[model samples]
Target chain A: MDRNGLEKQCLEVRRLIVKSVYEAGSGHPGGSLSGVELLTTLFENFLKFDPKNPKSDSRDYFILSKGHCAPLLYSIMAFKGYFPVEELKTLRKLGSRLQGHPDALKLPGIEVSTGSLGQGFGVAAGIALSLKIDKKVNKVYALLGDGELQEGTVWETAMAASHFKLDNFCAVIDSNKFQIDGSVETVMGVEPIKQKFESFGWECVQINGHDLKQVDEAYQAFLSHKSGKPFLIVADTLKGKGVSFMENTEKFHGKAPSPEEFEKAMIELGEKAL
Target chain B: MKKYLALREIYGQKLVELGKNDENIFVMDADLSGSTRTVLFKNQFPDRHFNMGIAECNMLLFAAGAAISGKTVFASSFAMFETGRAWEIIRNTIAHDNLNVKIVSTHAGISVGEDGYSHQANEDIALMRAIPNMQVLCPADALETGAMIEYAAETKGPMYIRLSRETFPVLFQEESYSFTPNQAKVLKDGKDVTLIACGRMVDFALEASHKLEDEKISVRVLNASSIKPMDSEAIIESARKTKLIITCEEHSIIGGLGSAVIELLSDSYPVKVIRMGLKDVFGQSGKPQELFKFYELSTEDIIKTVKENLQ
Candidate 1:
């Protein structure tokens, strides 16, 4: 799809994110909105996945290391037709396949079950290492929150990925600044991310996460890099990207929009409010 | 003197044999490859072996990742770090997803000797047994360790195999010994009292039974190797016949074999029971034999417990 087409899909995903969280009555919206374009562009342009055969051996793997952003992941997977878009309403409900966190066993296309932060990144490294050992060309990708970077395990994975020379692995940090407590900088600064990753032997790049074009280019660089080094995309994003009231704020980091707020978000995305 | 063999050494050798037969077998260690003996597997299949540095949490999650991708991953470390430090990772990532990751940890219990309380995993069996979809196995000797590893490889889902740092007396013959999960091995049978033990303590229990034999104090020794699916049938039968039971393990008395047996019998056939292990205390630096005696887990302790319970 072209840039215009991808931009349209991102808007649709944002609307879905608002609607699902509103329907669920309690869910995260800030980080979910921020990750809209990064995931939308990859699923549409790069990721080698067949929604029908989610467990196919030939497919590339994607893990949401920052699993609190399940709203965003569920929206993209639904848009990609992994399951009915309507089923997303059941998210976080009792007996729902779309758990509050991504449950790989219950939901197809979720390559790993992750919620307690920094775990999915390590799992992604393991998958990439397994692929390299088997001489398979399937790529492994994981999306992490800047807050999630505080977890010691993330650094451990970063070190292992580089030491083992997992060229097949790529990790994108959604540097949205805000976490539930407050901005990541104030909470526990994880700045100098690019330098840290580079020193660990990973080829690093900084990108505007919300810009579809830059997200595409970052993924492109990862696919083309011939250096036997893991790739890190330090994506700078807002805590909440789309809605006016929620943008760059910690309030919506985990709070669902009120009925009045939900209608406003839908209207802002150019959709008719329910 | 009884012949003693290192369980970790046998584990390393068995992994190489399993790796040769199955191309998908992968081994991971957390910088303790030399001590855990995964160095043996590493020497054989360098491509399939991963030395995951000193990070235990990342190693377990990595093992879960490889397992989910259709590989049977055998991850090793000292039991304290493997089962204690990375416990939440094992539960949330590996056990919750029911991945094919076999955590074969060495240096379990006070047998870790000189390493002291921080290194000893006296609560590993209890911790592992509580997790859903996790199978906990403790091998009594070299032969049982090999058989349990083989069984874990063939079986699907998450499993934890506990191995001791101290060499144990070889009790099972290689040709005849086979591991069946949840089935207790009847080492010897008597009507007066039942002595149930797992891991290194099984040897002590057997010794106590022989000493009791001379005194006409008939004792039954049951090797309760599979701690989770714990041979409920055998425990109940022993309880019914003997009416007295003594449980032993080289672990905390709280959640290991003794607790498992009592938990079962109390619900089914409640009998006079005495549990022999570290009674809510941490182990200090000492020789394995000295630690066992200090912790009241020696053969003499078992014999005394049995004789007292019978009275």
Candidate 2:
């Protein structure tokens, strides 16, 4: 796909995420918008495995460790044909496979059930280690919410991954700044994110998350580096990336967009017939 | 009934074997290696073993990451310490998502003896059994404990198998005894009444049954090592055949074997069930045998309970 087409798809995902929440009446939109392009790049390029064969042992695994931001992950997986894109509307509804948190038991694309923060890195590290041991070169990707660094277990897992020298693993922290309650700066400063990673012996990279070229380059660069350290990419992102009203706002962290806001978002995304 | 095995010895040996064959099997200790008997694994496979200088939470989370990477990690610590200190990490990191981790905690029940209430973890089963996707095992002896080590290592998801510091007789042979996770073993079956128990309590239950048999009261003794799966089929059948039933364990009556038996029985066939346990009181510092007698967890207590039920 061309760069413009990929960017368009990412914007479309951001709009659909707003719409899904507007329809569901409850969902996380803040981090979802921030992660749209990354998820798009992952589904379209970096991650292996045909969506037709979700359970193939050789497939590269992706875990949205900040799992509450299911809107982005669900959108990407549905678009990638892991499930019916229409089912994305049923997210957080009773009996919907799209639970408030990603359930590996319920969803084919989800590798492990994760909602509580800071622990997915541990699980992803394990999966990466397993792949490496089996001689399968499929990389394991896990995305974390920067606010989740308040959880000590994440750092604990980070140390173990670095100690074991898991180069097959790559973790992306969505530095959207705001958490459920407030901004990470006020809540718990996890700044100097790169230094912390370096202290833990991880290969650290910082980039503008909204820039698709940077996101793509980071992926390619991570692959090329044979450092015996786990790769951590700290992406600086707005809490809500595209829509003006939602940008950097904690109100949209877990709230559904109103019907009026959804219309404006869809229009901004250039959706046709809707 | 006549014999039981101390699980710590077998836990050590089985870990060494697991570490030898599977380089992916990692063992983490929290400076309790000598007490928990995980020293054998550490001695045999130094590379795969880690002692994290008394940091239980780090040990648990690190193990979670290691287990995720395709390593079967056996995390060893004192029963009360690890289960209490690092429970949330264990629940969220390993068990909640169903990571393959073997949580082997020694000094369970009053058997840790002179260490007092702080060291002995009577509530270990209770805490572990509450979590979803976690299987709780309390092996009757060392042979079964060794067998359980391999079983838990092979099984997917989180498993907690309680062990004891004190050594007892080797109940079953290392070569032939079969132990399956969540499957209760019927050691001595009788028609008069049923006595269900786990861990060190199984030994007392057997001894009580022997004494009762001398009085011509045939008591069925079952080793309910698997606490979570509860073996409802065996429990119901036993309840139906034996009109009176008694449950014995080293933990509190609130959430241990006694409570589990009552829950199963009340849900299905209501029967006369008497619970014999620590009765929700904290233990004291003393010799293990003295604590057993003082706390009424001894075989004599079971024998006395059986006689009272008969009357």
Q: What does candidate 2's lDDT look like per residue over B194-249, in tens digits?
A: 99998888888988898888989999988998888889988888998888899999
Worst window of 10 by summed lDDT in candidate 2 chain B = B1-10
Predicted candidate 2 versus true structure: per-residue lDDT over A32-119, tens digit per residue: 9988777788778788867788867678878889989988998888888889889988999999999998987788877777787866
Task: Enumerate residue pairs that collide in model 1.
Answer: none
Q: All models, DockQ values?
A: 0.82, 0.33
What is the per-residue lDDT of model 1 for residues B32-80, given as tens digits with 9 covering 90 to 100? 9999999999999998899999999999988988997899999999999
Q: Interface Cα RMSD for all candidates?
A: 0.8, 3.2
Evaluate model 1: give its TM-score: 0.98
- Candidate 1, residues A142-222, lDDT tens digits: the string is 999999999999999999999999999999999999999998889999999999999989999999998888999999999
The Cα local distance difference test for each model comes to: 0.92, 0.84
Which one is best on DockQ? Answer: 1
**Native-to-model Cα distance after best TM-score fit, residue B137 in candidate 1, in Å:** 0.4
